[model samples]
Target: MTTQELLDQIRHKRSFLCVGLDVDLRKIPGHLLEEEDPIFAFNKAIIDATHHVAVAYKPNIAFYEAYGIKGWEALRKTIDYLNKNHPDIFTIADAKRGDIGNTSAMYARAFFEDLGFDSVTVAPYMGKDSVEPFLEFEDKHTILLALTSNQGAFDFQTKDSEGRELYKRVLETSREWKNSKNLMYVAGATKAEYLTDIRKIIPDSFLLVPGVGAQGGSLEDVCKYGMTKDIGLLVNSARGIIYASNGKDFASAAREEAEKLQAGMNAIMRQNI
Candidate 1:
């Protein structure tokens, strides 16, 4: 989806909530396991319940890849369902893929053309060539990993090189790449303070922020530091929302959790206006 279209959805829904569909068979309701496609069934239920409150859904590729072919099929079905029913909602393939130019092109096509995701997460360590291929797709976004929520991120991302931190350089350098206007960033909500600096570098860019809820990132803090005039933030809650219950009430429970977050975002947006 185009950025303006996404922003319009946020306004219509009164939310910037991005529900993470990082499903784990071990954690889902046992009753779902009896279904033909357990994963897609679980996802469909959640989407149906929460789509009104959420503007986006991100499916972490690792969760599906671990289950192999069946897992991939489930993912495809989930995206197809979304496109067929809720095309206005942004879809993200949290694959974190980056490689040589040709390989990156293939990865881009796999997500953008084949699976039909509106965006995909990409690692930036491989530099311009690795990411440019993904950015080349018009109206599709490439969310590059910047300041991640993981503890190990500090080991390299915040390290000083010359006078600036590595991630700061990543933000600065990426803006100059071809089709850079398509770039968004992954700024972990756990590192909300870092967002103040991040926004200084890319004031208008949308940030795909994870690490809220279960990861202990404060939604209020993220809004304080990360929000832009366009409400440029997609705050994600994975386990906290999806795994809210492991019983038959899973989808209803997930919707309740999502509604809470969306309400919070709605309040923030109201105050901003």
Candidate 2:
């Protein structure tokens, strides 16, 4: 989806919520395992229950990859379901894929062409060449990992080199690549303080923010600094919403949790406008 289309959805839904489908067989209700494809079954119910409250859906690729071919089938079915039923909802293949230029291009085709995801999370450690191949696709987004919301982020992302943090330099240098306008950065909600400086660098680019809800990052703190005129944030909640309950009422409970976040996002959006 284009930036304008995404912003319009936020206005229409009064939400900037991105529900993360980080599904694990162990964590999901035991009853779902009775189904042929437990992962897709869980995802379908969650999507149906919370579609109105969420503007985006992100399925982390690792969850499916761990299950091998069967898991991949589930991922494809999930994406197909979303595309057929709710095409407007921005779909992300949360595959942190980055490699040599040729391989990167193939990964781009797999997600964007074959699976039909609107965006894919990419690792930028290999620099612009590795990431630019993903950007080559018109209107498709490459969400580069910037300041992540992990304990290990401090190890490399914050390392001082030439008096600037590594992530800061990554953000600055990414802008010089071709089709950078289609780029978004992954700024973890745990790194909310850095949003101020991040906004200074690329104020208009959208940010796919994880680390809220289960990760304990505050939604209010994220919007306080990360938000722009277009509502430049997609705050994700995986475990908090999807795993709200382990019983049969899981879908209902997930809706309730999503509603809570959507309501908060609506308030922030109102204040911004």
Among all candidates shown, the one with the greatest lDDT? 1
* lDDT for each residue of candidate 2 in 120-237, tens digit (9 for 90 to 100): 9999899988999999998789999999999899999998855988888899999999999989999999889889999998989999999998788999999998998888999999
Candidate 1, after superposition: displacement of residue 77 in Å? 0.2
RMSD in angstroms between candidate 2 and the native structure over all alpha carbons: 0.8
Count of backbone collisions in candidate 2: 0
Query: What C-alpha lDDT does candidate 1 achieve relative to the native structure?
Result: 0.96
lDDT of 2 at 6: 85
TM-scores of all models? 0.99, 0.99
CA lDDT, candidate 2, residue 236: 93
Task: Flag regions of model 2 displaced more than 4 Å.
Answer: none
Candidate 1 lDDT score at position 64: 97
